[model samples]
Target: MLRLHRSALYYVRPLLRAALELTPSKSDTPVTFVPTVAGLLVRAQNENVAIEFTVEGAGSGAPISVPYGSLAKVEGRQHEPLELAATLEGNVFRWSEVGIPQVLSAPALEPAAWPSLPAQDCANDAELLTALREAAATTDIASLRYSLGCIRFRGDGGQLAATDGRQAILLSGFRFPWSGDVLARRCPVFTKLRLAATDERHVGRTEDWLVFRAPRWTLWLKIKHEARFPDVESQIPAREQADTTLSLAEADATFILQKLKHLPGGADQNEPITIDLNGSVAVRAKNDSSSVTELVLSSSERSGAQVRCCSDRRYLQRAVQLGFREILFRGTAAPLFCRDTRRAYVWALLSAEHCLKHNEQATRIASPRAATAVQWANSESNSGS
Candidate 1:
């Protein structure tokens, strides 16, 4: 019997989950049982190098020989003793003792016949490939699992959609090649497109590698969740009273974030920070503790345009760091809309309550009639948050 240390077991669990998620689950024949193992092995390709034993597994009958390239790369002594083991029972493969059980659930068998796709016929692959890379980065290897059937391509351009519940991004422009039956199959496949004779766009077959064409550029990615992405177009605000665009230098934005960093009770629901934008040219943020940070925007028109809202400072900080040229504060009560004019990116909404709690004087700002308005604003912001 092999006994793995608690730390070693923890390390191997996520690795096994990631590997298993990438493997094809549909069995042509009945699979008895497959228990995970952990052990180190010397690379046959590069015998001089050794790899740590993160995860390994075997079927019920014979020992499984995995390719050296198939293993996820980790830093450590390559020649160390690698733990390995496996068991088989019917078609289901379960991890009997891989150290971390919570990291992975038994992967369900893939359907025999997956939903069909049209065909693949595309010229440019830049957009699809880029979107894939961005999406893959948003998810961890252990959390991503999805099957790609044949993709039919048509038109001069195509679009890729990615989402993680909190945020969604859509990139458009590419060509798709259309093929009927060819697009129907459950397997990981990469689609490479020649953006230019010299430039290539590579979309990963799964999340493991970023398949793109560029000289001297190599990228790898982990698989991402394949759940249906959200409908982003529907979330855009329908109307805007004032489209105030301000291009603050990155340094200025950083300064604003720093000043607003410390608010009441940090990010709790009770200790809200108030953002007063209605003043002449200064944006004022104050907490219950009388700590006030005022940022003066470079604007000549002060106009009594002040609106008060509350938010989690951390969330706001992240939004600012995402590099939007102008922060579009739409309607005081809803999530503040931030967009980068240089790129088509929209951030997740921040809640009004989270912002409101920062200001101990939020109730004073709302009247009986205005209470309904405030509630509507908060509800909208909460939905986006």
Candidate 2:
């Protein structure tokens, strides 16, 4: 019999669910519970990644494997703090809540038959998770450019880079122990698991796998070939190449973001929003039926030039979200560039033809100036009512 706090189980539930996500729906997933001196060790894996964590408590019995499908049906309240005892008898595994009469049972599998997992001895101190996540966000998962689906960690200066062809992010100053470059697929599990501050994070590499390890849990991602990835350093434009620069104030950024919240197609990050700089900064978003156009900041607020560019709304939003106050634009055909202290982002601006086509569509709707005022007035009126 094994007794453990429900809090411990709840703490590891996200990892379990993330493991489930790694496999296809039709597959019958088994979560192995190995009897360890510390407590119970839960392990799950798929083709792309594997995850396991030790839940420390009381345990004394043979290791048992339980199907996640059956376990999910009776996992009980997740947020409630309680104690539970589990026991494996013959082919069935059962767990009952302490102080409660309710007991749940699930079919069991032979623990010895479970596939062996890779050993983790992660001592690398590169702190690559944060950089990996930021670079991974720029990868193109659905594109045929397979190389763009992976993040490259350069051993030279510990630079992490990824691009979706449309956008790219580069993070420098990471210190990796590996002397050669490593290309790793941007797996969601790496970013999904939350690491506690108390837990010492480390990265490990074997012949075939790259491992991310913490105190109680570890995850491994398959390494990819770096031969296909493009030379990221050469792709970034030189500082002098920028022909126009817009330094937005905090208030200007906030107003633009607020207006975006009310715009159509908030769900589609790829939706185009044109930023026009003439005497004022005008932001516009339009769909088939409705359109939103507003002058977020006047030229008096900041110096302006006659330049216009269409960009992915999410790309722009991400720059603002990352506390980037200044963005550089070379021309409509050039990529937009922004950077913080350690990271730089390059967003490919939509072509002039694309912007023109969208503008023609917007012509069917009310003029930007009038439409924005009307929408703002209507919203205010509705709120007052």
Candidate 3:
């Protein structure tokens, strides 16, 4: 029987769901479990994404290689196959389900030696993890580019950047101070890393993998093969171009989008909504059968150019759910930069093409903290959100 922590599984659960999204065949998807001196490795790779979830030891001595199906749960030898035994508080989970063939027939990866990486103690572990989580939240898992499916972190000195094609997020001035660079020695280069954050004793990396070592918890992740991250910096619109700025409440933004989804003809993918900021904040949409006009709460910068920013209802709505207190909407066509309002560290952009770029500007939010919501990607990586 194999044993591991429930908390560790919390970190891994999202990766499993993502891998499942990669493959259409859900019935017999394979999951391989392998053990190493560091911890237990839960690995799955499909055409879209290849993810490895690692959990530090629970003092169970050595771990063995085992295979399982997506639906199978850990069970004891005497328990019925219908029952499951797993906990999240670091309790041990017993895996002994005996009925599923795929669970019994999965392949085991050849045991490879782990690489030695530079170990450093970081102070802002939780904040860093939160940043990565924010980035991962904005990533498009369904992207055709295999690299786009995973979260990318390109940091130099203290700056980090991540993007999902349509939108880009940049973060600078992190709190951690290291003798050597975290992901790599070079700066401004992209490194596809697993989303993980914690104040473990030693956090280090090898050429191919990042290893997190805690007394009772551990994570191992394989970095993406591509060395180059997309060039998002060149695409960001300059601050001066924003003809309109708004201080829309995060809750209000969420409420408006949620209500639009309920509108009879407002939620379809093909249906586009015009967020007219020329006057009172409003959402305008129409379909073959009907149309919707809803008032949104937001303060305008000016009545200058009538801004008619058009975007997919769902995409815009999803952007609002990112939980930023306020967002700065530059103008139509140009990307609307979203941020914490209280801090400059976290920021996100609505997809540039889908949202369009360069537009007639008019409208302003009341006293918006000027900044972008930077994308913080999958932390507790190896177990990412």
**Top candidate by lDDT:** 2
TM-score of each: 0.43, 0.77, 0.59
User: lDDT of each structure?
Assistant: 0.36, 0.64, 0.45
Worst 10 residues of 1 by lDDT: 42-51
Where does candidate 2 stray beyond 4 Å? 19-27, 78-91, 97-105, 110-128, 264-270, 288-292, 298-305, 354-385
lDDT of 3 by residue, 1-385 (tens): 4545445554554456553453445534555455666766765544333345555542333333333333334322232322122233322323333444322223333333334444553443444544555555545545665344454443344444555676666555454333333331111111223434443434444555554444443444555555446555666555455566555654455446446675445555555666666666566555566534444454323334556666666556655665544445555556656544222211333333443222334122222212321121112123432
Considering lDDT, which of the candidate structures 1 and 2 is the better prediction for this target?
Answer: 2
TM-score of model 1 vs. true structure: 0.43
Cα lDDT tens digits for candidate 1, 340-372: 321333445445554432333322212113225
Candidate numbers sorted by TM-score from highest down? 2, 3, 1
Instruction: Give candidates' CA RMSD values in order.
Output: 14.2, 5.8, 10.7
lDDT of 2 by residue, 1-385 (tens): 5555555665666667764463447335767777787777777765656677887665666666666664444444543333333443433434445656555555665543433344544343434566667787888867776588788877677678999887788888765556677887777655676666566777656766667777787776667754478776666676567777787766556545555655665555577777776555666666666655444453213243567777878888888876777788777777888866677888778766535222433432222243265565466457863
Order of quality (lDDT): 2, 3, 1
Error of 3 at 347 (Å): 12
